[model samples]
Structure formats: C-alpha cells, structure tokens
Target: MGRILAIDYGTKRTGIAVTDELQIIASGLATVPTAELMDFLKDYTQKEKVERIVVGEPKRHSNEASESEKYIQVFLKALEKQLPDIPVERVDERFTSKMAFQTMIDSGLKKKQRRNKALIDEISATIILQSYLSRG
Candidate 1:
C-alpha cells in the first residue's frame, strides 16, 4: 500500500511529512524551498508511492481564507495537473505553527534547536498530517 503525504506550504519554505506504508504513522520528511517544492514532490513521489496529499489550508481567525491561500491555490492547481492520479485535500491549519513550537519544547529540544525555523516547519507538517489522520 502507498503512504499518504502532507504539506505545510509557506511562501519561502515548505514542510513535508509522510505516513508509513501502512498509513499508520506520520513523520516529518523535509523542509524545502517553496520554489523547489514541485521538483521535490516529483522526486519524492517517484520513490515513495504516495497515494494522497494533504495540504494545510491557511485560514484566519474569522474563518476566512488567509493571504497565503492565493499561493497555495496556484500551487494546488499545478500539483493536480502534474499528478492527476493522486488526490489532494486541504486541512485547516489554524494553530499548527504554535502547536509545533509547543511540541518542540515538549520534546525537550534545546533553545538553539527550537530556534531552527526549518525544524519548526517540519514539525508543523507532521502536526498537520496527524490532524488529518485523526479527523478522518
């Protein structure tokens, strides 16, 4: 069976997470530059046999689409076109960043490690994927 993948898309960087082949465990995969996300996904999917993609949907306090939604939408379209066989869904990403930070502290990461934005992004992606699995 193929694994499910999740993406926490950002303007400058994107965090990636993937589930185990049985789709039981979600783990952070990588933090790549946004400009290189498509290439990264292509290469990753070729090797990982991803069945679906869960992208974080940026939302505001009022439950409206956040500004980042524009970029995500564009990327989503291209992703769909490039990989029409794999389905994609967007899950609410309201407080994943804050949660990621708290998770770092909870994990006993040192101050310097917690300060790594790339690490936070990766953790956030894992959180996003976990949220989708729990909800589904």
Candidate 2:
C-alpha cells in the first residue's frame, strides 16, 4: 500500500506528516509556508507514493466548525483539484497543539525549543496522523 499523508493547515504555515508504507507509524515531515504547500506536496508526491491525505479539522467547543474552516475549505478544494485521485479525509484536531506541547515537555526539550512554533506544528501534525492510524 502507498503511504498516507497528513496536513495541519494554518493561515501562515502548514505542517506535514506521512505514514510508513505499511501505515504503521506517523513521522513528522515538514512545516512549510501556506503559499508553498501545493508545490511542496506536488514535488513530494512525485517522489513518494501517497495514497491518501488526512487533514486536521478544527472545531469549536460547541461542536461547530471553527473560523479557520473557511480557509481550510479553500485549501481542500485546491488540493482536490490538483490531486483528484488521492482521497482526503478530515480528522478531529482538538487539543493537538496542547498534546504537542506536552510531548515536547516530556521529551525534555529546553524552554526555547519547546516554544518553537514550527516544531510544534510538525509535532501536531504527527499527533493528528498517529490518531488516525490508531483508529484504522
């Protein structure tokens, strides 16, 4: 089976992750500028056989879509248009950032390293992908 990819889309930056060919483990890929995401994905997919994509879906406490949904919708549409064959799925992303932070702390990262937003983003994407893998 081809590998699965995950995206944590943000306004300024997007975090990326991918699963092993067996889909057993999720690994952090990179954090890229939002504007560069499409090109990055296109190139990455050209080199790696990606079968599906999982995107983090942020929701409010009331179970409604978050304000970021609009941007995410646009991103998803673009992805669909560019990669029509690959299926895209949305997974709940509640507390992913918090979990990332806790992971950094547990790993004994320095305070400065823990505050690195880009690292956190990548870690968050990993968590999101891992959660999906666990479910499957």
Over 50-127, each residue of candidate 2 has an lDDT whose tens digit, in order, gives 999999999988989999999999999999999999999999998899999999999999999998998999999999
lDDT of 2: 0.95
**TM-score on alpha carbons, each prediction:** 0.97, 0.98
lDDT of 1 by residue, 1-136 (tens): 9999999999999999999998889999999999999999999888879989999998999999999999999999999998899999999999999999999999899999999999989999999999999997
Top candidate (TM-score): 2
Name the weakest run of 10 consecutive residues (lDDT summed) in model 1.
Answer: 42-51
lDDT of the candidates, in the order given: 0.95, 0.95
Q: Can you give the lDDT of residue 122 in candidate 1? A: 92
> lDDT at 79 for candidate 1?
98
Poorly placed runs, candidate 2 (over 4 Å): none
| Candidate no. 2 TM-score | 0.98
Clashes of each: 0, 0
Question: With candidate 1 superimposed using the best TM-score fit, by how many Å does residue 78's alpha carbon deviate from the native?
Answer: 0.9
